[model samples]
Target: MTVKEIREKSNAELLNDIETLKAELFNLRFQQATGQLTNPARMREIKKSIARIKTVMTERELSNQD
Candidate 1:
């Protein structure tokens, strides 16, 4: 997801999205281990998406603290 889209999500929604992405990442790893992953690039994409969400969350937390 783009940063703009991520920024639009509320904190609760962002947390939920992070959880969902982590689950998907876990499943992707399982598929990779079994050599059944059709789209290996998806793993990287998911990881980046998780990072983006976390970045947004951190930004929000810092803003709140200020």
Candidate 2:
């Protein structure tokens, strides 16, 4: 997901997206292990996306805590 797309999502939606992306990343890892992955670079993209979601989630949480 692009940062712009992510910025548009509400926190609940972002959480849902994170869950979905993690599942997909898990599947991709399995595919990579089995040499069935069509695009190995996808793992990197997914990983980065996950990080972005988590970062935003944390930022929001921290702000709320203040």
1-66 in candidate 1: lDDT tens per residue?
999999999999999999999999999999999999999999999999999999999998999999
Show where candidate 1 strays beyond 4 Å: none
Give the lDDT of residue 9 in candidate 1.
90
Per-residue error (Å), model 1, residue 24: 0.7
Q: Rate the local accuracy (lDDT) of all candidates.
A: 0.95, 0.90
Compute the lDDT for candidate 1.
0.95
Residue 17 in model 2: lDDT: 90
lDDT of 2 by residue, 1-66 (tens): 887788788999998998999999999999989989999898999999999988888887899999
